[model samples]
Structure formats: structure tokens, C-alpha cells
Target: MHKTLSSKQLIINEALRLGFSDIGFSTVEHLAENEIHLKEWLDNGFHAGMSYMENHFEKRINPALLVEGSTTVVSVLLNYKPKLEQSDPEAPKLARYAYGKDYHFVIKDKLQLLFDYIKSDIYPDLEGRMFTDSAPVLDRAWAVNSGLGWIGKNTNLIHKKLGSFVLIGELIINMEIEPDTPIKEACGGCTRCIDACPTKALIGPYQLDSNKCISYLTIEHREEIPEEFKGKFENWAFGCDICQEACPWNWKARPTSENEFQPHPDLLQMTNDQWHNLDEDRFTELFRKSAVKRTKYKGLKRNLDFLKKK
Candidate 1:
């Protein structure tokens, strides 16, 4: 006779089958520590133009408030490591995460499917909401609380097995599950990520000033690139991976198995000329399903122009 699988085992198995690199569970509770840090970050205006970070102060820390009757927050990590690099080394660089389909949609879809499975087959009356970075969720904090990984000095979730090249998604449901213990901080005198930042975005260990972050300036900041940051971008035109690339944890990262995360042939072959002459039509065709779409054609051109000026 087969032994019945516990809800935790069932959930973990399904998550792995869905291509999640790892999964962890956490009880829905207020993130008091994260809340305090968030308040300080906001008070310092470190979020830059991302005003939405300030809108849901309470809901951001309380999982129960986001999903009524929620007791469990299941965090999943999907690795996005790239198998190939751009053929032209001098071409404007794109972040590894934007090489393929937008992860917000990819992870959110998986989370919804997981939600449906739990509701229909396991719990029957389960009510939950799936959250990617698209929501007000403090994804790293939740992932860390769920024992997914410790937040590194670069502020990315660093898994012992997968490094930090992974996307995080959460499923908050009304179910009690075994919660994983939070991992202890592991940076331990390592400051490679901090020292690697071109613009000094990592002000200190685990602290970031978004105003100076290359990823933020390239992807989120709408205005002209700040003159103060001239010659500092290092040719990044989409998102920057300098911090992650410098982290020792990422030295052993394996490429992702998800084919949808593969970089397009055209994207890999793009030269500086090709990127400079990128018309709206080609841009639309190449990034139609990519997270690079968030920057839009104009924003990408802005980033490219900034790098050109460097």
C-alpha cells in the first residue's frame, strides 16, 4: 500500500514538476523586521520614482491581509540562468532575466495553476492569490522568511544551490503547512557585490539606493540618464547584472532548464550597429513577450544612448 503524501510533500512535488528550482512554506505573519527596514528605506527616498512602494505599507508586510484567511505562504524560485551569451561582446548588454519571456507572466501562470490544483484536488475550498513582483508583496522578504534563501548583500535572494539568478513567486492560501526555518545571513565579510557596483548602488551590506542602481535607471527611471552617472553604466541597456555576476554564490550556478527563458537568436546576434539602428518594428518583434517590454522602445533607446555617451 502507498503511503499518503502530506500536503507539504504534495506541494513540493508539484512545484518541482512545474519547474520551480525550490519551494518553501511560511506561516502568514507580519514581517516586523522587514517593515522596519522598509520604513527606513522609504523615509530615505531610496525607492526613487517607484511611488507604488509606499502605497501599501500594511498589506506589504501582512500576508493575511492580501489573501483573506491565508495561513500559508508558499514561495517558489524559478531559475533564469542563461545558457548562452550575446555573440557580439561589445553589443549593448541585456540582463539575463529579460532574455526570454517576462517572468511576471511565466511565474504568475505557474502560481495560478498551483492554486487551482490545490483548490480542486487537495483542499476543495482553498482561496488564495498568486503574487509575483507585480504585486505589493515584498518577495525577497517572504522568500527569506520561507527559508528559500538569505537576502544577499546585493539584496537578491541567494539560494545555496541556485545562487540569485531566480525569480520568486508566492501563493498565499488558507491552509496550515509546515513552515521552513529562516536561513541565517551568510555574506560573512564578503563584499564582492558591493565593490563591483559601478555606481555605488549598494551603499552598505544589504542596502540599496535605487536612485543609483543601474537596473533602476535603465528600466524604471523615465527621464534622461543622470549626468552624474555618465561613463558609469558599463554599456548595460536593459538591466544590470554586475552585482550578481560578482557574487561568489553565483560561481556555481547552472543554466536554467526552461526553454522559454532561452535568449532569441536575433537577440544574441545583435551588434552595436543593430541595436543603434533598432527600429520600432524590430524592437516589437524581438521583445513582444519579454520583460524588456517594460522599458518600452523609447526607454531602451534612452538607455542605449546613455551607454553610447559613455
Candidate 2:
């Protein structure tokens, strides 16, 4: 710590220059608000088979416990809005986030760059770690505290101006920074995200049934695709974007400026039938570096088979 807050603004400025669309800083505190919701969801088994969510209870709250003497959490949002969308209405779909390189690698590089820049320019002595969705860090809670955005009914960060198409990453540092004012809930009285859920996964405002969430089914759940959810996935083959598509904030959505976020040539030209018959070879060439690789070939084929099933 430099015994001042100037170093805090220094980190945020560097994050913006590095192409992060939004950045916010907050003092590390226990996840007081999110704890009850999480515990209840877990108790109800809403996590489905994501047993790991139940593994890190205390760590998911107090940042200081995870990182020795951690004082501040810095949250950054990189927009992942794709430059192109699936063209065919009948095409089996993929999430926009998976259109390019795996976000874990993509976001980690940017976060590490931020850390290195902080080490050289802001505080050479400061120690911290950066993680996107890859860590036990409470990224959404930190983002809300930092005022970057409000957690919408969909449980995703909803930016007032930037919308929900952003990718969140964090750097937890021992040094203090100028705290960002928390963003107010701009969701108003709108229930669009709740009402539009195909599986009725939205239990209420700001709540979701993760077991029924399409994204969870297609991405996180490793078991058989639930027969009940067969046609409810809409056209999404990998992950669902229906709530985002139904959001008003997305109306002014612009293409992300990050070139790494851009889609591959094979992905851009995919047709509905091509996706249906897609085999291992084409899968490797198109998605070798893509986030879709997280689900692996067999998982994707499972989803595809589920989609084509009568």
C-alpha cells in the first residue's frame, strides 16, 4: 500500500486502456447478501450435480480469507457480444460467448496483463490474483458492490448502459483503491427475463431454478440431456441466450471491439444442416481454440443428438 488511494485509480485507468469496457473497485467484505440465497439454493439442490459449488462456502464469501490480507476486489467487464449471430432460424445454436476462443484463456490473459501492469506501474510490491469464472471468487457480488452492474432476474450482471453481454473478471489485491459507487437496480418493474424463460426457471424476480436453466442443461450438466427438456431448449444446441435476447438493454447492443472475441470463419459460415451432421474432425478444426471445447466433443454430440431426437 502506498498509504494513499491514487494507486487505486491507476489500476482502473490501466484496465480501461486494456479494452475492459467497465471497471469497478470495492473493499473486500463477506458476501453478506448472497450467502443466504446461495445456501438456500444449495439446500434445495438447485446446483443439480455441480457439487463443487458446495465445496467452498466461507471462501466464496470473505475474499481476505482466500488471499492473505486481501483488502480490495477489482472487477472488470469485457463485452463478449458477437459481431455475428447464427443466421438460420432452424440451425442448432451455440452461445455467443462460445463463438471464439475459450473465455477462460481469453479473460485470464487480460487479467494477468492487468496484474503485471499494476506490478510495474502502480505497485511493484503489491500481490494479487486474477480470475474470471475460473475461480471461487464471488465475481458477481464484487461486481454489484463495485457498482458495475446489478444482478438481473437472470442472475447475470445487467449493465444499465452496457447490457448483460459483458464478461466479468476480477483482481483481488492487498492494496486499497478508490471504491466505486454501486449501480442502482435499473431493472424497474420489468419481468421480461422471468416471463420469457422457456422452462419457467425464473422462480421470481432476481431468482432462478438452476436445475431447469437451459444454460445449465447444455453446458454444466454432464449427464444425459433430460428428456423433459428436449424441445424446451428452443434452438440452442450448446447454451441459451433467450433471456438476453429478450432484454431491453440489448436493444442498443453493439459489437465488441475485442478482436479475440470475434468468431472463426467456419463458425460464421455454419448452416443448420452442417451443425446437425457435424462430426469430430470438423469439430476439432472449428472449435480447437473455442470455449465450446469446455463441453468436449461427446457432450456436444449428446446435445446434438438430443436436439435431433423425436
Candidate 3:
């Protein structure tokens, strides 16, 4: 006789079938512990110019606040590890995550399917909302609570199998499912990510000073790149991935199975001259659906010009 799978198992199996790297469940409650850390991070002005992190304080720590009557937080991971890198050794680099379509749309669509599966076949009355990096949700914290992975010293969620090259999404619903146990912190004295940071942005283990981070300086920062960060960008014209690249857990990271995450044909083939001569029209064509569009044409040119100075 076959053993019956619980509601949690059913959901997990369905999520995996939908091509998610992994899925886990957790109880919805006030994240009291995270509140302190978040407050301290905000108090230190670590959020930098992204003042929006200051908004929705209550909703960030509690899922139920975002979705009424929510009792379960279903966390899912989608691997974004690329199969290839830029072919030109001298060309400015882009963070692997920005190579493909914006993850917000990709993951949101998948989460809706998962949500529909839960309601139509299982719960039938599963009222909830899905979220990716959007909204005030503390994504990494919830992933940890759901036993998806532990937060690495670099502050990225690191699944033992999927590594850090993964994106997280969630479904907060009214139904309760058995929560998964949290995993152990596995960095274990690895300081490669800290030492690998060219701008000293890591500051200390598990601490990131975003004001000095290359990813933040290149993308989220709207103003001119600071002079102090000159030459520290290391040819990155978009986002930086030094910390994730330095993590040992990612050494064995396999390429993602999701074709939607694949880079455009010309993306990897772009040469230094092509990037340097890029115009607004070319930029639009190359990054038509990519996350790289976040930086915009002018912003990318700014980064490219900055790299030339080095």
C-alpha cells in the first residue's frame, strides 16, 4: 500500500513539477527576531538611497499582514545559474541574474500557477497572494524559516544543493501546512566572499555596507558613481557578483533548467567595441526583456564610461 502524502508534500511536489528548484513551507507569524536586525540595518542607513525599505515596517515582518488570514508561507526557489558567461575577456561584465528576462514576471507567473493548483485541487478555498522580490516581504528570512536554506555570510540564501544562484518567491495562504525545519549555517569560516569584494563592501562577516557595494553603486544608485569607487568595479558595467562567485557552495552550481533565464544569443557574443559603441536603439534591442533594463541606456553608458577610466 502507498502512503498518503500530506498537504505540504503535495504542494512541494507540484511546485517542483512546475520547475521550481525547491519548495518549503513555514508558519505565518511575526518575525520578531528579524525585526531587530532589520531595524538595526535601517538605523545604520545601510539601505542607502532606497528609502522604500523604511516603508511597510509591519508588513515586512509578518506575512499575515500582507495577506489576511494567512497561516502558511510557501517558499519556492528558482535557479538562475547561467550556462555561459560573456565570451569576450575584455568586455564589461553583467551579473548573471540580469542576463535573461526580468525575474519578477517569470517567477510571478509560476507562483500564480502554484497558487491556482492549491486552490483548485487541494484547498479549493485557498485565499492568498504571491510575491517575489516585489512588496515588503523579507524574502531571504522567509526562505530560511521555511527550511529552504540558510542565509550565507554574504547575506544570500544558500541552498545546500541549489547554491546562491537562485531566486525566491512565495505564496501566503490561509491554510496551514507542516513547516520544514531550518538548516544549519554552512559558511564555516569561509571569508572568500568578504576578501573577494574589491570595494570592501562586505565590511564584516554577514554584514554589507550597501553604500560601498558595487552592485548597489552600479544599479540602485541614481547619481554619479563616487570617485572613491573608481577602478573598484572591475569591469562590471551593470551589477556585481563577486560575493556569489566567491562562495564555495556555488562551486558546483549547475546551469538552470529554465530556458526563460537564458541570455540572448548576442549577449554572450558582445565584444568590447560593441558595448562601447552601444546606442539607445541597440541597448533596447539587446535588453528588450532583460533585468539589465533597470539601469537604462544612460545608466549603462555611465557604468561603461566609468569602467573605461580604469
Candidate 4:
């Protein structure tokens, strides 16, 4: 006779089969500790220009509020590390996360499939919703609560096995499942991410001032790049990855197995001159389905121009 698998085990097996790096479950409740930290961050205006962060105050920390009757938060991690790097060393850099198709869609689609499996094959009456980074959810907090990983000093989630090159997604459902134990913080005494920041964005351990973040300046900030940051960008024409790159845990990160996360061949081949000369047509062609499209052709050109001016 075969031993029976628990509902949690069944879900975990299905999620892994769907290509998620790992999955964990947590009981849904008010994230009281995280609330205090979030309030402090917001009080300091650390969220910068993203005023939407101020909205959905209560729902952000309470999964039950987002999905009525929700009792479990199923968190999953997907590694996005790439085996390839830009071929031209002098070319403006893009963060590894943005090298492929937008993760929001990729992760959400996978989550939906997981949810469907749970509802159709496991819990026929299961009612839940899935989310990537496309919501008011505290993704890292939930991931931590689910024992997925610890939030690193640089604020990225660092899985001991997968490192910081992972993305997070979630499924909040009205079901009770055994919760996993939270992992211990692992960045003891290491401040490589802080010291590596070209713009001093990581003001202190585990504290980031988004206004000074290169990733924010390049991708999120709608205004022109601030003059004070002129030379600090280090030729990053889009998102920056200095902090993650500096994290020692990521030194041994294996490349992701997801084909959807692979960079376009032309993207890796573009030289500095080619990037500088990129026209709107080429930009569209290269980044048609990529996360880089978040920064439209004009924004990318602006970033390129900023690098040239240095």
C-alpha cells in the first residue's frame, strides 16, 4: 500500500512540476511585525515617488483581507538568474531580472495553473487568487512567513540554495495547511551590498532609500535622471543589479531553467555603439515582450544619453 500525501505535499509537488523553484505555505493573519517596519519605511518616505504604496494600507499586510476567508498563503520562488551575460563589456547594463520576458506575466500564469490544479484535482471548492508583483501584497513578507527565504540586508529575498536571483509569487486560498517554519536571517555582518551601491541607496543595513536606488532612477522615476547621480549610474541604461551582484550568496547561483527568462539573442549582442544608435524600431524589436519595455524607447534613450554625457 502507498502512503498518502498531505494536501500541502500534493500542492508542493504540483508547483515544482510547474517549474517553480520552491514553494511554502503559511497561515494567514495580520503581519504585525512587518506592519511596524512598513509603517516606519513609509513614514521616512522611503517608498519615494511610488505613492501607490501608500494606498491599500490594511490589505497589504493582511492576506485574509485580499481574499475573503483566506487561511493559507502559498508562496513560490522562481529563479531568474541567467547563464549568459551581455557580450559587449562596454554596453550599458540591464538588471538580470529584466533580461527576459516580463516576470509578472510568467509567474502569474504559472500560479494560475497551480491554483487550477488545486481547485480541480485537490480542493474542488477552493477559492483563491494569485499574484506576482502586480498587487498591494507584501510579497517578501509573505515569502518569509512561508519559510521561502529571508529578506537580505539589501532587501532582496535570499534563499540559501537559490540565492537572491529569485522572484516571488503567491496563492491565497480559503484552506488550512501546515505552515513552514520561518528561516533565520543569513546576512550576518556582511554589508557588501551597501558598500557596492554606487549611489549610496542602501543607507544602512536592511534599509534602502529608493530615491537613491539606481534601479528606481532608471526604471521607476518618471522625471529626468537627477544631475547629482550623473556619473553614479555606471552606464546602467535600465535597472541596476549592483546589490544582488555584490551579495556573496549569489556567487554560486545556478542559471534558471525557465526558457521564458532567457534574454533575446540581439539583446546580449548589442555593443555600446549599437545601444547608443538604437532607434525606436530596433528597441521595439528587441524588447517586444521583455520587461525592458517598461522603460519605453524614449526612457531608454534618455538613460543612454545620460551615460554618454558622463
Q: How many collisions between residues are there in candidate 3?
A: 0
Candidate 3's TM-score = 0.97
TM-score of each predicted structure versus truth: 0.97, 0.96, 0.97, 0.98
- Tens digits of per-residue lDDT for model 4, 30-106: 99999999999999999999999999999998978889999999999999999999999899999999999999999
Per candidate, the number of residue pairs that clash is 0, 1, 0, 0
Worst 10 residues of 2 by lDDT: 1-10
lDDT of 2 at 240: 88
lDDT tens per residue, model 1, 205-271: 9899999999999999989989999999888899999999999999999999988898777899899
* Local accuracy by lDDT, each model: 0.90, 0.85, 0.91, 0.91
lDDT of 3 by residue, 107-215 (tens): 9999999999988878887898999999999999999998989988888999999899999999988987877899989999889999999999888887888999999
Worst 10 residues of 4 by lDDT: 1-10
Q: Tell me the lDDT of model 3 at 178.
A: 79
How close to the true structure is residue 225 of candidate 2, measured as C-alpha lDDT? 79
Error of 3 at 262 (Å): 0.9
Question: How much does each candidate deviate from the true structure in C-alpha RMSD?
Answer: 1.8, 1.5, 1.7, 1.7
- Lowest lDDT 10-mer window, candidate 1? 1-10
Once fitted onto the true fold, the runs of candidate 3 whose alpha carbons sit more than 4 angstroms away are 1-5
lDDT of 2 by residue, 87-170 (tens): 777888888889888888888888889999888887778898888887678788899999998998888898877799999999
TM-score of 4: 0.98
Q: Candidate 3 or 4, higher lDDT?
A: 4
Which clashing pairs does model 1 show?
none
Clashes of 2: 1
User: How good is model 2 by TM-score?
Assistant: 0.96
Residue 169 displacement (Å), model 2: 0.6
